[model samples]
Target: MSDTPQDSRRRYSAPVVDGVNKSAGRAMLRAVGFTDDDFRKPQVGIASTWSQVTPCNSHIDELAEVACQGADQAGGKGVIFNTITISDGIANGTEGMKYSLVSREVIADSIETVAACEGFDGLVAIGGCDKNMPGCLMGMARLNRPSVFVYGGTILPGDGHTDIVSVFEAVGAHAKGELSLIEVKQIEETAIPGPGACGGMYTANTMASAIEALGMSLPGSSAQNAVSNDKRADCAAAGAAVLELLAQDIKPSDIMTRAAFENAITLVIALGGSTNAVLHLIAMANTVGVALTLEDFTRLGKGVPVLADLRPSGHYMMSELVAIGGIQPLMKTLLEAGLLHGECLTVTGQTLADNLAGVAPYAAGQDIIRPLDNPIKPESHLRILYGNLAPEGAVAKITGKEGTRFAGTARVFGSEEEAQARILDGTVVAGDVLVIRYEGPRGGPGMREMLSPTSAIMGRGLGNDVALITDGRFSGGSHGFVVGHITPEAFDGGPLALVQDGDPIVIDAVADRIELQVDDQELERRRRAWQQPPPRYRRGVLAKYARTVSSASTGAVTDLPDTD
Candidate 1:
C-alpha cells in the first residue's frame, strides 16, 4: 500500500533527525527542548512576522507561543522562527516607506530559507501587518509545504477615528485650517488603541481576508480584535491546522490554485478591499505558477458588487463588521449569491463549503456589510484604465463617492516630497492632476505607497476636485480620485515622464480611460529626450532590489526562482 501522510518516511524532517549520523543535529535541538520522542514527530515551523515597529505586529510573539503550545498539544514538535517586517504605517510618505514593499520579498525569502534549511515538514506563518500576510502566503506557496496562515487581527480604533487613515486626512484638514492643531494632535495621540494592523479594510485586513478566502488561513480568521481571546484561539488553531494539513499531505500548491485566486479577487472586491490586493495576489499567484493577471481582475470583478460599507471609502470601521460576527457572514452571503467558488479546497483538507458550514448570518440592522442589492457600488470599486496616459494600464480605485470624470491641468512633481510640499503650500488647486512620477518598483527602488498626498488632498477639501496619478502605488487607506501603478513607469520613459506642468489631462473612471491631450508626436519627442536616472544606491539590499524587481503591473515581485 502507498505510504500514508502519517508514515515516518513521508516526513521532510525524518532524515534530519532519524539517522545516527544526524545525532549532532538532534542534540542541538535537544538543548532547546526537543527530545528523542519529539524527533520522531513532525517539525512544524512557527514563522512569526513580529516586530516592535508598529502595533500591528506587537502581539505576534505571544501568538507564536500560543501556536507552539497548540502544536505541542497536537503531538507535533513546533520550532519557532522569525522573519523581518517593516511598518508601512510608520514608513508611509517618508524614505522609510521605500522599504515597505521591499520587505515583502525579504520576508518571503527569509521564511523559505529557514523552513527549507531547518527541515520543517509543515509551516504556520503568523502575520499582522499589510505586507506580512501576502509575504507569508507567498513563501508558503513557494516552498510547496503544508502550511497555514494566521492573521493577528485588526487594531481597535480609539474614540477619535476608525484608523490611521483618518489621522492622515485630518493632517490635510489641519493644514487647510479646517481643524485646529489641538484637534489634530488629539487624534494623533489616541488613534490606535492597541496592537493590530491599521483599522479599516486596508491592505493588512484585505490580504488577511483574501488569504482566508484563498484557503490558506482557517475559517473566520480574518476579522477580530488583536487583543481578544478569539484571536488567541485562532492563532493556536492555526498551529493545529498545519498539522492536519500535513496529515493529509495537502500543500499550499494544492490550495493556491487559479480558481482559488478568482475567489480571492471576488472577496477583495466584495469587501471593497485594498487596490494592493491586485499587486499582492498577482505576486502570490506567480509564486505558484498560477496565471492570474490584471485582466483576470477586470474579468472576474465585473458585476461583483462592492457590498461592504467599510472605510476608507465608506462609513463604518472594521470593528463594526467584526461586531456582525466577522467575515463568515459576508462570505456566506457571497456563497449564496454564487459569487464564491465553494468547491475549492482549504487548509482544512475540506472544501470551502465545508469550512463555511454552520456560519451564522449577520444580525439584522447591521449596516457594516450591505446586502447585495443595496451595495456600496453596483460593481467593484477598482478599475483598470487605459489610454495614451497609461498605455500599459493603470489602476484607479473608485469608491463610487469620488468624482466620475475629471479634466485637469497637470501639476507635475518628480518626487512625492515635492508634491506634498506644493499641496501643503496651497499651490495645488482644483482642475489639477497632481502627477508624481519615477516612483515605481525600479525607479523608487521600492514602489512607495502615496498616502500622505492623497490624504492631504482630502483634508484640503479638494478630494472631488483634485486628482492624482503616479507610477507608484497607494496605501489601502487612500481614497478619492487617485490613479496609481502606471506601468512602463517613469523610470522606463513611460507617458507619466512626459507630463509637463499645465499639460491637459483627463481621467474618466466611468469610461475606464485616462487620456493625455498631448498628441503622439509630442509624447514621442519627450520620450526620446528622457534620460533614465542613475541608480540611487550603488550597493546594499535596496540596490539589489531595484536591479531585480519587475514593474508593479506584474506584482513587482523580485524572487521568482524560475524567472529569466
Candidate 2:
C-alpha cells in the first residue's frame, strides 16, 4: 500500500516530530525506506490482541492488515504488535477468570511499553471480547496519545433454529430439561463456533459498545458483525482516524472526559449492558485519574432508561442491532432526548452531535432501539445495593420485573455444587433468599460467574419469587434480581461470611439495599468467629492472583505491575 495525495498532504501538514524520540523515528524510517524528511509523518502503533486460544479475537490478525492498509493510505507508518488474549470458557474451574480480568492491565501496560520503546506517535487498539477493550483504554489513557479502538465486532447469529437463541435462552432450555444432553452440547458448540456468537451482551459485546460510547472506538463500529465487510471498512477507517488524530493532536485524555464516561454509563444502562462493565469502567476511569464509584453507577442507573432491547435482558443480538443501526443511531436517540453529553468529542474529529446527524431516522425504523419517550424500562436497568450484606456495594440488573422487593429467610450454600444439588432436588421455596458466598475475587480467586446456580434456581420455577444473592459475579445474559460482586467478600470476613442458614435476608431493589435480618451485634459476633478457608493454590498464577487481585468493584485487576 502507498500513501494517497490527500494522505501525503495530511502527513505533511502535521509532521509527527512531537513527543516521540526523533532518533527512534529516524531509525524506523530508515528501515522502512523513508528519509529524515519523512520522519515528520505520523507514526501509528497497532496494538493487536490476537492469540491462538482466543477464538473471539482470532480474526484480529486479518483486521490488523486492513488497518495497515488504512494507515499506509493515510501516509503513516503502522507497526503491528501482539498482546495476551484471555478466553473465559477455557479458564473455567480455575483462577483464569481472575487472571483474565488482570489481563487488561497487562495489555494496557504492554501497549504503553511498546509505544514508549518504539516511539510511535499514535495508537490503534484492535481489541475484541471482554478484557482487551478496557485494557487498551487504560493504557491509552496514560499515554494520552492520539488513539482509537477497533472492535472486532460480535459474531453472526447461529445457524440452527435453536442455535440462534441467545446465551440466556440456550442455558435456560438446558437447565429446564427442554433440551437433552446431546442437544445441549450441540447447541453450545454451534452457538460459539469461532469468530462470533460468543454468547450475548455478555462481557464481549458489552465492553465493545461501552468503549464505543466512551468515544474510544469509531462511531458505528460497535455493532458490525466480525466477518462482515463493514467491520473491515471500520478497521480501515480506524487506521485512517489514528493518522487524523495525530495530525489534530487529539489524545485519549481529550476525548475520555467525565462527560464521555457518563455517556458510556448511560449507554451501558440503556442497553442493559453487562454487570462486568461496572467494574471495567471504574478501572478505566481510575487510569485517567477520574473518580468513579459504585454510587455513580446507582445515580446514572436511575436517570438512564433502558432502550436497547438486546439479549440477556431482551430478545435481539448484536447483528440484529447492527441491522437496525448501531451505536450511532442509539447515540442519536440519546442526543435527541437531551440525555447525551452533546459537546463530547469523537475520534472522527467531530462533536458527538455532529457524528449523530441523520442517525435518528435510521433508528426510528428499528424497534430494537426504543425512543426515550417510550423506553423499554423507565430508568437504568442496573442498580447498586448496600446494607449490612454489602457495606461497600453490590450490583443488580433489575429490568423484567416490578415490585421485586422482598424479605425472606436465607438458604445459605457455601458452594455452587451444594446450591445446584438443592435446587435440582426441589429443596428451594418461594420468597427464599438464596445466599451463595465465598465466590468473590479473593473467595474464588477466579471470580467465576454464578450462571449455573442462578439458572438452576430459575429452572426450578423459583426465579421471580426467589432472589439470588452472591458474592460472586453473574453473566450479562443472566437476568432476575441477582446481586453480585459484593465487596469485602466472605472469604475476607465480610458480612456475607457471617450469614447462617435459616437467617432472614431482605432485598429491596427499589430501595437499593440488601440486608441480613440479623442485628449488627450478632453479625459482628459471627464475623469475629469466622474462619478463612485454606489457600486453594500454593503457587503459580493462582497464588499470584490470590495475592494481587483486587475486588470486582475495582475491575478485579491485578495489583502488580507488568514486568514485560
Candidate 3:
C-alpha cells in the first residue's frame, strides 16, 4: 500500500534509516544493536508493559523477547520498549489507588510517544493488567499502524481455588470473626500463586477477550495461561501477524470498525464480562473515531446472553475456561447463532468468521459455558441505569443471583476507605445502599476501583442485602448489588454528591433506573447548599489528572475535547 520501494516492508523505517541525512538516528539505533541489515528491514516496536509492581505483568519481559524473536524471524527489525503499569489490586483501597485509571492514560501516551519517535512500521503491544490492556489498544488506534495486541494471559488459581478477591474478602471475614488470623494470613499468602492477571474473568480477562473479539488480537490470544507455552506462542504469533498486517496495509482503523466493536460487545456480554468493559470499550472506540456509547451497550444487551459461568459472580475462573478450549469455540457458537459479525476483519488478515471456521466447539457437557437456550442470565448482566441519581448513566452488574432490583436507605461515605471501614465493622448492614461518592474520574483524579469494600461486603455476608452506588468505578472482581460510573461525578456536583445519609435509594435493573426517593425541591435545596470539596492533590500527576480527566460517562479519557 505504500509507494516506498526501498525494501517494501520499510515504509516508515526507510525515512529514518535509509537516507544519508538520517545517520545520527541510525547511529543511535546502532548502539542499541542495530546492524546495517537490520536498519534496512521494517521496524516493529514491541511495547512491553513489564513491571514487578504486580504479578500480572511480572512475566511480560520474557513474552516481549518471544515477540521480538518472531518479528526478527518474520524479516522485521524488532525494537523493544517499556511502559508503566500500576497495580490496581494492590492500590484498590488506599490513596495510591487514585493512580490506577490515570495509569491507563499514561500508558497510552508513553506507547504513542515511543512508537511515533521511533517511526516503527508496526507494533506489538503486550499488556498484562486491567488499565494497560485498553491503554495499548488506545495507543495502537492513535498510531493507526499495522499493530497486534498480546495479552499477558490470566493467572492460575491459588490453593483451594482462592484468588486476590479471596484475600480481600478474607480480611473482611477475619474482621467479622468468621475466619481466624491464621486463616486470613494463609489466604493472603496463597491467593496469588504466580505471575498472570487476576484468575477470574475480571477486567484484565474481560478486556483481552473484548480486544480479541474486536479483531485486534489473534484468535485464542485472549484465553491462554500466563506461564503456558500457548501464551508464548500467542506473543510470537502476534509479532509475526503484524508483518502480515504491514504487508497488507491493514492498520488498526481498518480492523477496529463499528461492526468489529459490535462483535466485541456481543462477546463481552455473552462472557458476562466486567462493567469496566463499557468504560474501556468506549474509550477504545473513541480513540479509533468509532461512535460507541452506553446506549449501544443497552441496544446490544437486548439480544446477547450471559453464557460464561465464570468470574466474581460466577462459578469458575479464566484458567478453567482456557482448559475448556478458550473463547474460540464460544465465538464459533455466537457466529453460528448470528450474534457476531462474520465479515469483520481481524489481525490475522482474515474475516472473524474465517478465523473461527475450524474452531471446534467446547467439549460436550462442559458447564463452564452454558448453552444459549439455558444461558446464565438469558440476557446481559451489565445494566446501564439512568435516573436522578445518575443524570447521565451508571453501570451495574446484575447476574440475577444478586437480583435485579434493590431499594434501601442511603449510607453515605466520601471515599473508599470510609465505606471499607464501615463494611469491615458492623456499621454497614442489610437494607443499606452504600453511597460512595467523590471518587469518579476527576473526583478521585483516577476513578479508583472499589474492589476492597465490595469484597468486604461479600465477606461480611451482606452481598445480597446491601447495595453500593458510586461515582467511582468497580473492579470486575467486585460483584453484589453494586452500581458505579455515575456521570457528572460528585466533584462536579453530580446528584451523587447531593445524597445524604438515610435518604432512600432504589436501583431497578429491570426498569434500568437508579432513583433517589426524594422530592425535586428537596434535592434542589440540598444542591444549593452543597459545597465542592478541595482538590485532593495539590500537585503531581493526580492533580493534573483531576484537572483534565473527563466524566465517567465519557470513558474517563484525558485527551478528549476539554477534559471537563
Candidate 4:
C-alpha cells in the first residue's frame, strides 16, 4: 500500500560511495594490490547487446545510460559493456544467419567469462532483438546471479494506413501485386524506424514480453515503447529493481520457476505471441532444470485462449496494447479469471497478486485485448503434431489456417531457390505438399525462416490448398498450413531426405499427424541411396554451426557442455 518513493529506499537502496580513480577501478586487483575497502563494494556489470548493424537495439547506447544512472542512484558502481547483436532480418541468406541461433550460447559463455574476471555481484542485461533477449536469458539463467532483463520496448506505429497493416498483410500485399516494389521499400523503411517500431513485436517484442511474464523483469517494464521517454524511466526503474533483487538475494533461478514458466506460457498465448517463444522458453526452462516439452505448450495453450489481438495475429499493434493498459491489465484479467499463479514472486519482491492490485481496471470496451469469456480464439492457437514424417514433433498454428484436413501429392523442392522458381512460373499446384529440403540446421546451417516459399504460395492463390513443410523455422508473422522445425533434417539423413515428388502426404491437424502415404519399403529404398548434401560452409561460423547445432526438437542450440 506504500506508494511513496521513499518506501523503496530501504529495500532497493545501495550504499553511497566516494568516487574512485578510473585507473584504480580498471587496474586488476592483483596488479593494483587492492585492499579490503575496494573489494567491499558490490560491482554491477551491465551487459548490453547493441550494434549499429542491429537496428532494433541501436538505441541501447542511450538505454545503457539509464541503467548506469539507476545503479548510481542505488549507491552501486555500474560498469557497462557491449556484446554481439544478431539480427535475423538482416542476416537472412548468408552463413552468418545460421550463427544467430548458436550465438546466444556464445554470448552467455562470454558473459560468464567476463563476470568471472570483473567479479561483479549482479548483472543487468539489455537485450532488444530476437536472439539477444534469449541469449541474455540463457546467460543469466546459467550465471544464476541477481539479474534483471531490460527490454527496449516496441516501436511506435507508422504514419501511413498501409504501413499500419500487420507484417503478414504488408508481405501479402507485395506478393499479391497490390503493392509495388517502390511502395514495399517505403513500407519496409518506415515499418521499422530505428530502435522500437512495429518490427519490435515480430520476434523481439514477443521474447521480451516472455522475459517479463516469466518474472525476470520488473512488472510493467516489458511493454513500454522503445523511443518514448517512459522507456528511459523504465530502464532506470529496472536498474533500481536489480539492486533490490540483490538485497533480497533473488537470483534468476529463484524467479524463473516452473510456475513462472507456466505464467509465461499463459502470457505468450494471450498475446498471440511468436512461435519462436516456444523454442526460447523451452531452452530457458531447461536452464533452470525444468523439463518443458512441446506437449506442455499444447496442453497449456488448450486452456489458455488467444486474448490479445496484436499484429500478425490481429489488427492492433503492441504500442496500443501498452497505451491501453500494458501487461498489468493483461495479467489482471488472467488473475481475475484464476488463470495465473498469484503466488509467483517478481524481481520487485512483490507477489503476482500484489502486482495485479496496482493496475487500474481495463476500460469498458477495448477490442485490442479480448476477455477470457470472449477470446480471439476458442483454444490455444498453437498445437504440436506427430506422425511418421515428424515423429519427434512439428508445430503448427491452428488459428493460422482455415480447413483442418489437407491431403496432397508432395511436390519436392530440393532448395528454396527451386521452390521460388516454380511459384514464379505458376507451375505449383493447389494440392501440393511443398517439401523444402537442405534448409534445416545441418542443411542450411542457419535454419533460415521459410518466408520465401510461403509468401510465394500465398501469392499464387494456393495458400489454402498448399501445405509447406520444412525442417526449418518460420517467421511468427507467417500463417497458413505451414509445418516448421522438422527434426533430423534432410542433410542429416532423416526421412525427409527421401521424400520425392508425387509422394502422397496428409496433414491432419485435428488428429495431430503429418503422414507420408508412401510405403515403408519404398521410403527405405530411397533413403539408402540418398546422398547427404555437401557442407554449406567449408570454413567459418557456418561450418562450426553444422558441426555443433542440435536438431529443431532440441531448441537448435549448440551441443556444447554446460560448464558455466
Most accurate candidate by TM-score:
3
TM-score of candidate 2 versus the correct structure, residues matched by position: 0.88
User: Lowest-lDDT window of 10 residues in candidate 1?
Assistant: 1-10
True-structure lDDT of candidate 4: 0.74
**Reference-based lDDT, residue 235, model 4:** 81
Off by over 4 Å in 4: 1-39, 93-96, 161-176, 197-201, 459-461, 559-564
Candidates' TM-scores? 0.98, 0.88, 0.98, 0.89
Tell me the deviation in Å of residue 562 in model 2. Answer: 17
Instruction: Assess each prediction's global lDDT (C-alpha) against the native.
Output: 0.88, 0.76, 0.92, 0.74
Q: Which stretches of candidate 1 lie over 4 Å from their true place?
A: 1-10, 561-564
Residue 548 lDDT in model 2?
81
lDDT, residue 78, model 3: 90
TM-score of 1: 0.98
In candidate 1, how many Å is residue 183 off?
A: 1.9
Candidate 3 pairs with clashing backbones: none
**What would the C-alpha RMSD of candidate 3 be, to one decimal place?**
1.7
Q: Per-residue error at 281 for model 1, in Å?
A: 0.3
Q: Provide the clashing-pair count of each candidate structure.
A: 1, 3, 0, 3
